[model samples]
Target: MSYEFERESLENADDRIVAGRAADGDTVAFAVLVRRYTPMMRAYARRILSGSADVDDVLQDAFITAWEQLAQLQDPGQTKSWLMRITSRKAIDRVRVSRSYTDLTEMELPAPERIAPPRQAEANAGVAALNEALLALPDAQRECWVLREFGGYTYEEIAEQLDVSVSTVRGLLARARKDIIVRMEDWR
Candidate 1:
């Protein structure tokens, strides 16, 4: 299936239903969860992991980890963010555990240009630079940025997800944005 079709199908489903069923040993429901979240997870992992081919592997491991830990989850409504949290941690570990001196490549994902007008070329370049700068940031910094910008989570939500103080999240976000702006200025 095309990525767009897969993504649309997954997003259209009731996440609560999927989570509840998956929590009850419903493999199909769990598979649905995997299918629904895999693209986002892969995008996230790719950003953190760079050019490693291990993005898929990390996502798979994340799903398995989520499955095993489902029973421990107190709120089914929070499953999506919880899964994303696990995925991010797993991707971070893959980078940390790598022993070889491998030169990393730039991480890339398909853009939405084909489906929309290209009027925002300059803005797109800014976003691309921001994304690259983001990839180079510390994991905590990147996580805070993504959770705030992409996941639409508030500072409190990010702090809760990351088990950090809200002040820490605020500091991370400030550092992240300042670094991104500096790098983007260099690109201009």
Candidate 2:
């Protein structure tokens, strides 16, 4: 088969088929998986890490780990979730390692000067308010909220990923929701 035909076929295939092909040593299938999941993985990492600085590195590491470990995946159908779990773990590890040092350079201010239309300005304000609220959350609660709300992991899945009890995940999410609600209300 021609390379374009093969690539198109892989692109149209479902996750299970693509994952199985990847496990069978097809780099094209793996690349397809990477293209499909990279955005979601980046977003998840950004939320969990609460910044963009290390998000790409964490995601790249997760993809490398996924490539090495793909054969161990018992269900090809669950590939997306598996990738997300890898991303969440890597992001958490980055946070843990970086907790020891405060980067003074990161504290520097950025050059800012653009103004938007009224509608865009209002939307941007809401988004900024939401981001501030998220940043104010405790790390554990933030992780739980991101994993559940952004990463789309179930409570049991989050508990396993976080190495915490399900009840703890619930409590953390509840507290996160309450705090975010109060913070957002103040923004109005």
Candidate 3:
């Protein structure tokens, strides 16, 4: 089948089918996966990188890596988490190379979606405050929090990514949560 026809057909296919095709070197199937997951993967990378300016770069690198390694994926059904893991690694790798997080004295929050009415004004304030507090956290604490909360990674997964013990991941998350809560008390 032509790539265009295959792409169209796969648009509504289950992730497993799309992933299976992609693994078999079907570029159209891979593009479908890309279109399906890019927004979420972008958001995951952005949160992990703490609104870094390199979000697009990270995403590009991640897609390249995913396309290259899709065949090695053991279970096509698990494609989403696999992509997320790649994105998280790509994001963390960027952080490590730049060491930018250690020096993030202030970070511009990724803009919030505009609400239609002023009634939700306080919601924006809460988001702003949370972003500020997250920026203020120690690098380890922030990584743990973002990976678990934003990435939806398991504690063991976070530990493996961060190269810390699960206990350490738990501790970091706790401290990060406490610090955020303290910082956001005014929003409450």
Clashing pairs in 1: none
Work out the TM-score per prediction: 0.64, 0.74, 0.77
Question: What's the lDDT of the predicted structure labeled candidate 2?
Answer: 0.83
Write candidate 3's Cα lDDT for 75-178 as tens digits: 99999989988898899999878866622223344555765566366656677677779779988998888788767899999998888899999899999999
lDDT of 2 by residue, 12-113 (tens): 999999999999989999999999999989877776666548989998999999999999999999998899899989988887787522221233223346
Model 2 CA lDDT for position 87: 91
Off by over 4 Å in 1: 1-13, 98-105, 109-153, 160-162, 179-188
Task: Rank candidates by TM-score, best first.
Answer: 3, 2, 1
The TM-score that candidate 3 achieves is 0.77
RMSD over all Cα atoms, model 2: 5.3
Colliding residue pairs in candidate 3: none
Which is better, 1 or 3, measured by TM-score?
Answer: 3
Q: Write the per-residue lDDT of candidate 1 for residues 113-180, one digit (tens) a residue.
A: 55444545655666666767876788788778866875577898788777899999999999999998
* Residue runs of model 3 more than 4 Å from their true location after superposition: 102-132, 182-188
